[model samples]
Target chain A: MKRRDFLKNTAVFVAGASVSVSALDFITPKELFAANPQLKWGFLVDTHKCVGCGFCVKACKTENDIPYEANVTRTWVERYVIKKDGDVVMDCPKGARDGYTTKLLDQNHSGMLLVPEDEIAQAFFVPKLCNHCTTPACVQVCPVGATYQTADGVVLVDRSWCIGCGYCIMGCPYGVRFFHPVEHVADKCTFCYHRISKGGDTACAQACPFDARQIGNLKDPNDPVAQTVLSQRVGVLRDEYGTKPNVYYIGLNKEVR
Target chain B: MKNHVWRPLFVVIAIAIGILLFRAFYVPSDFGSQEQGYTFGYHRLSNEQEWKDYPEKYKGNDYCNECHDDKIEELESAHHGTIPCENCHGAAFDHPDDPEKLTIDRSRELCIRCHAKLTMPSSDRNDIPGIDPAKHNQGEECSECHNPHNPSLEDM
Candidate 1:
């Protein structure tokens, strides 16, 4: 072959190879980049309506296959008794799985006795669970990339991939994350993702007869829970942390943190 | 041109091409961020489906209504209307097909979960009719006198 022709072919091949390197982006499926902007899951808790029945806790444990005997729970209720003297007493015995039939005498283990009924100015139950924050601390702290927030705004932990480093657990401000006794991995609420994705209410929401707990798509204007969240004055737990939690409480009191 | 300059360049280009090819083969097609803004750029896209497929143990009243419409209808009209059927009877997971019948929870503890008197004056729990277990029918099962399907209704 002539030297000139050989030089031209080599130049074209090198340029073509460089151009093909940039085409690597095309290998990734287009669907992975297509974000569904319409759906964003949110939860609402009406503290005034929660009766401390503990049914939601039971349902969550059963639906998620969390060990019944294990003290760890994905969701729980806290009973707060505020004295007229401004001392706030809080306790969540057995994660409120069994009702608050027997009150905890030493809730903080500070050797403080239970305030008598007459000294109490107000008492209420606050159901607590994973906030499924917009900017989740757990997701940010996961070193192994096991925990992530889904497109629909639910934070999920890939149990198989979790290293159980407990960073995510410590990073959480609400103390929602726990190591599964059997799995020995960092675990928390999925917002009952298995049920909610299939057009079913969460196990906790469905078990709540009083309609105190609800899960809904915040993007959907028609959802009653969404309406309540948007139209009414709702508050989230530990807003100062800047996690931007999704769970909204209707009758949240000042005493609650 | 020096052989060293072109030789290293050629080798670097070949290695780059090799790495790209390996990535295409190794990385899953559905492994990446699902959205554009404010998203952590690492996650398995297929894990969403894996979570969605996780079996739900507590099938709500709608599942039971397929067969036990009569019981559902009766409960809906009564005081226990809001309570799920599975709440009292264990989670209707693979019901009738596997267990044939649900184990009815007729324990007094089950009944008292909502009815047990809490002395807190500022709470809404006082709205529900509560009784001290020691004072109310003690030791005897609540189902003996009250029909759990309709708690207000007296059992014959």
Candidate 2:
């Protein structure tokens, strides 16, 4: 083997190796995960703003078409009346109308809901929805790979793909996901993807009387949620658990204290 | 020699194309989920708080009042005046545009998702807070109980 021949072969090999490395570096696998709209829809729930109105719960049902008998809530407003004595409670048993409620008038006070009679022991309403977690335990636990995270951070379940195994139901830390009795698939808030995709708001967000529900693209910086997180002292539920949940609670109940 | 060499390569290439074609059209559907959200290691947060967004187009509920003169009046006068139509009834594109292919939540489940009792099997039954699911009927639709035209409870 001549010296020139050996060196030429070595040079070619080095060039090929460098080319492969460059290609690998240039094509980030993250691009494949890129959301076309590049959005992750989520919510910033202001507990302070919520007046314990069951509007969100009602709106979610009216929007999702949940049957009254299912006894399921895609979104629920938990009335927390912290009596001066320090007992946290809800307004009513959350009475019903026909099937779903569009009207969440503040017929709710603190009796069946929460009977509060103190300055410091006053109660507030907190609306809850799917955390739309980044590493959602619900998505992780699905035995049939039914639940999925969208490219833009939205956690979605393909109604067609869901196996109704209830694995997701068990895994959700927030207890928001449920199994559809008829469809037999795990279901939760799609963030109203069908509505939002076509340009609209989630029923819960719209139904909220106090603007307690604010939905936006967490990816977009100009959104009100971004401003809220940037300006206000906000907190998330179970942040220590590390779910990277998208739901933000503004003025979270001091009871967490 | 060239023929022998290219023949196998051509066959392999042909087979690959066939597979591609089969997948493109014949595939019934895709099952399972997709990548979404900020997973722990992927988009790790350095603090107790993070940026959050609402899950809808922030067109501002004010837009609901733009063309809906009569609706705005009724809604404002009704108990739900403060609430946006898009919120309670789901995005009402069909009603506004087509009315037939109504994109509304035409089923009873839409209402049930809210008004029905909340059930959490994983969380402590006593500790967890939500409406009790035992009181409502699972078979009826929202319109069956509440009248859409009048938006009332009178068995319309």
Candidate 3:
């Protein structure tokens, strides 16, 4: 090759290489969740705030496209009925779809038929969902490595990688995970990963008619989640299990499981 | 002996060069930021599309605030500032273009979800003062006495 041709070719190659290299500046560590470490998603369920509306249950089903069946529930609300004898009876019929005020048996009755008032000493509703633990037992037990925690502290299941093993379902101390009916894979709440990551609240949180459930990013100092965590005394479910669940409950009772 | 030596060494050198060339062109530049860098066969899992499965159905609070500035202002100053508007209104998936489609839920059961007294200890929770909805205001909607926007009952 001629000297002039060789020099011209080398110049073009260098310029092209430099341009391509500089383009990588946009894909910095901050862009890919490495340097940007100020976001940890969490949930707060104020038991005092819950009215057993069951809106959270319906919303989660709709958002996740799960079948609206009694057996298949991504989240459920348990109505704990403590008897006068100090016995606690918890039941959630179809995830409380009709709320707690529906007539128990309204056969040809004009007015509302209430639950027998004498049967209960004290009663309250507790909405349950995935805790998204700091040290998730489900992820640890996932034999196929399908269940993993994201950088932002979200526990997610790679459906494509999951082998339908129910190990995660069994390992979760909070009883959050389950084998998805149709998908046949271990499934649980993701803290509404897609929505929360984009600054939107969880389906359950947004569907809560009474603001009983709220999603918060603990890393953001100005977020309401920070204020709720710092100002209030929040408790987790089964703290003795030591899963370090991110879900916080504001008014947990001693008898609650 | 000389021929035997050159053949195997040349094959090894060629294989090394092939791997280097493949990595140079195929591996993502940003993979350097990841802890594993690029684990040859498993690098295919790094596709952005892998984790982008969930659809963005809920249209966040700011989207609602764009048009409902007055309502947003009222809520921000109220005790329920942190509560997003969609929580009560249902998901406003397409309300911007079709405002009439937006359904505002004013059901009494909606209010009762947070207001009804539970078995929680008094010291643990500060908000949502417990009220037996059946007896507190028998057969009356919560909004009859307290405005949802300001909820302190002083606005009534």
Candidate 4:
């Protein structure tokens, strides 16, 4: 072969190779990353319908295998009493596992003020759980990257990867994360990922007789829970933090925090 | 080129290639940052499947209906129709096959979880018939008097 022809052929081969290598950068297989845009999970709580029965709390404990004696809970209900004199009192006894039986305060020394029956104006209950934020602070603050958000808008903690740094527990604005009594890792509500992914209702949602708590696929427009969330005037807890929480509330009182 | 320049450049190139090769072998194939504009954080892609496969403890009422259709019918017609069967009788994780009989919770605490009254003036809780535990049938199991299936029927 001639020397000029050999040089020209070599140049063409190198140029083609470089172009192909650079093209590979733009080609990322869709299957490698499994973030399904079609599915998103959301939760709704109707404070008006909630009777503070604590059945949801009991079901959550049983379904999640949380220690019955542990002081921490994945979900709880708080009773708020707004006095006639504009004083607000809030308490969640044993995470509302037992029904609120008495009108009087059980523990006076706990620094909780006892509102007189005549002095009380109105009272209600608000159920609390992990907000499962779109921009979760727990996910951001995990030093070991153990806490993460699922593709379907649920936050989960990899117990094996978690180093018990407690940064996630501190970083959460909703104060939902807690140390698992047995596992000794950061744990919070998963919105019952096992149940929901299998086309079933969450334990808490199913146990709620009054239909106070409901979970649904937010991406599906036909879902009743999705319709209520999309059409109704709902509010979220602590919108100032910019977490973009997925949990929505109806008839949330101004006194609730 | 001088030995100093050429030798150092060769070492730098070799180390860069070595690091890339190590990463290719060390990192998991199904592990990486999430797709851009999707998830808020990075995670093992397979962990999503791990969570989904986790076994559920609270099997719903449909699982109970396979055997206890008679009790389900009576409960469904009663006032406590909305309450699930598993709520009172623990989670049916492995029922009948493993443990034949499910323990029934007949304690007063279980009954009063919804029936015990509170002082909420404007809430829906007032709509539920709540009895003061202190005044009404003190220290007696609630199931002893009222039939749980049909709570409206009094044994007295």
Candidate 5:
């Protein structure tokens, strides 16, 4: 080959290398957090603002189009009323999707509804969901590597990867994960990563009628979700299990404890 | 730290690749796809009917009528007119006959499957997005309190 031709080819190669190297910078971990170095993954659920409307549950169902066969609780709200005698009690009168509504409307089963008398001088509803723990047992005990913690710190399952093993269900301290019957896979909340990371919020967070649920990036100390966690003496469910979960509940009731 | 910088780069790069390789291949499949395990779920054997799928199934709405005929009639009258049955039940090719066969994938996991779709609350307008489980069913799991058959909680 001529020297001139060789020189031209060399020039092109150098230029290409420079451009390719710079391109990688565009792919930095935006979905991931490096400031904390722990890759924190979790959520902030404000109970005081929650109205027990069940919007999060419906939003999750409609948004994800959840199949009917998975008889487990993914995301849901619970109603708790403690009697003046300190007898703490709770009820899911509006149990699951199509649960109480269909029956109460049915004349045959309508009589079964047990509308609880207000427990406190005034009573309120509290919602519950998967904790997505820091040291999650579900992540640890998953026989297959179906579930894992993302760089952003959210614990989630890849349905395609999940083998329908219920180990995670047993491992979950919050009793949130369920073995979906139809998909035959393990499923739970991804902290609404689709919306949260992409500059949006979660279904349950937005669905709260009384401004109960709030989502935020822990990295940004100014984030509202994080602020809610700080403002309220919120608690993680089953902290004793040592999952170090990200899902936080504010104004939790005796029923939850 | 001049020409020797590449030496540190080489060591870090090699270690990163090694960790990636181990995570990608050496890890067990059980965490994601358990080759061994056991699972038992809710199913009605006595009501062993097939999941429905009509030839003219525009939306799974027809199956809703066949199963919960009353709810379908009520849903038609409610504000939930444009909503389709499959909106909640993903691709019901075979729901009734063998609900055990394919999964409808409910629970909280369903929320973030789509890219860039947000479910954040407390933003004032909860519309543009979708329904929230709490308010929709009034603290009950939509399925438990309300039956998809008729799509109403009139007392169910």
Candidate 6:
């Protein structure tokens, strides 16, 4: 190329670089430049500590203002009673609203009585809620970007933007997402986003009378959730799905899916 | 150049430049501030206010701690320190202002939610024991034996 052409090209290149750099400044906001909190919220559920009183379930409904209904739930406790033959009888009658109580079954043709509590090999209450996964399947499957993970690692639903397609409900391996009966949008536990963002615990965790459900910030080294998760044996639900769930269980049983 | 190619190509490039220039002016100056790196239109959703202002049902622990400082201090130092007061008492939406509205859930079922044990895989839960409510204190409220705030009964 001629020297004149080369000079022209160099000037154009320099101008383009300067404009692009300045354009980036406009695109990126000042708040983004501020120091990130680097907080990742997590939950720990101790099954052994859970008594299946269903208070957490009730608390979640109340805290989230979930309308009174049998089908929709942000959280629920499953009572799993494993028989001696390894048959697991899981029940959460009315989401355990009345709590678990022994009910004598009518005698069968063989005149067998209800299986004695002592005879049952094992039983435990596994309280289930949104895992708030690191790589959430619901977020991944969202059709209109309605479901998204915040910078702090809490998965949330943009209800206004959600189409109520129910893709997230089906995509979630933990089955946390549900279509709100009245709102007609896909909804699930947000780890109490409104509360947690203001430095409060999740509704269920805060309402856990026995401290069975605990919410902590993984970013803070002093946070119990961070310390416990690092020091203790924590298990995430459905690890095979590779969702990297933030909700960990302290005494997760093999019987638990 | 082909007879038809030059005219269409020139028009397409002009339109493309026009759109880009228009977009450059249209996008807000603070559009991508909260978001890092380049996204086509990610920041528009970040600017929304609805996500931040959902109707909060639980009034939060701080609200309770404001008026009940003594109870907060006692619970903070007790074995049940981790348990929030609202767990035993229902969410006090208008408490302190309307203290009478706060419902203290002293139901036996409330106590059993965590105190009653079910079997699970063996792991360390710090020996947080559970009792069959029926067997432990039949027909008796949990508060009869153990103080809800100070379960260790040190204060008593």
TM-score of only chain B in every candidate structure: 0.75, 0.39, 0.61, 0.80, 0.30, 0.61
Clashing pairs for model 6 are A28-B33, A29-B32, A29-B33, A123-B119
TM-score for each candidate, following the candidate numbering: 0.83, 0.59, 0.62, 0.84, 0.51, 0.69
For every candidate, how close is chain A to the native chain A in TM-score?
Answer: 0.85, 0.76, 0.79, 0.84, 0.73, 0.81
Which should have the higher lDDT, number 5 or number 6? 6
**Which 10 consecutive residues of model 1 chain A have the lowest summed lDDT?**
A24-33
Off by over 4 Å in 5: A1-41, A68-70, A93-122, B1-156
Candidate 2 lDDT, tens digit per residue, A1-257?
99999999999999999999989766554654553555767789877655444656656675566665566767776644455566644433443323222212234442222232332354445667788887788877765545666665666665655568787788887888887766677778878776666667777776665677888877678988877777788888877777888888877755642
The TM-score measured for candidate 6 stands at 0.69
Best by DockQ: 4
Ordered from best to worst DockQ, the candidate numbers read 4, 1, 6, 2, 3, 5
Regions of model 2 farther than 4 Å from truth: A1-37, A90-116, A254-257, B1-81, B85-156
Q: What is residue A229's positional error in candidate 1, in angstroms?
A: 1.1
Q: Evaluate model 6 with DockQ and give the value.
A: 0.21
Angstrom error of the Cα, residue B8, model 3: value is 26
lDDT of 3 at B154: 67
Local lDDT at A77 for model 2: 63
Cα RMSD for predicted model 4 = 7.8
Give each model's clash number: 0, 37, 1, 0, 95, 4
CAPRI quality level assigned to candidate 3 from its DockQ score: incorrect
Best candidate, TM-score-wise?
4
Q: Compose the digit string of candidate 6's lDDT tens values, residues A1-257.
A: 99999999999999999999998787565544343566778888888777666767777888777786746798988777678888776666666655554433223344423556566777677889998887677777766666676666667776656788989899999888888877888888988877777777777777666778989888788988889999999888899998898999987888898
Native contacts present in each candidate (fraction): 0.58, 0.17, 0.12, 0.69, 0.00, 0.28
Candidate 3: which stretches are off by over 4 Å? A1-37, A103-119, A220-222, B1-53, B60-90, B94-156
lDDT string, candidate 5, B41-153, tens digits: 11121111111110211124555677768766877765444344454455454556645344454543232111112222322122333453334544444455444444444
DockQ values for all predictions?
Answer: 0.35, 0.11, 0.11, 0.41, 0.03, 0.21
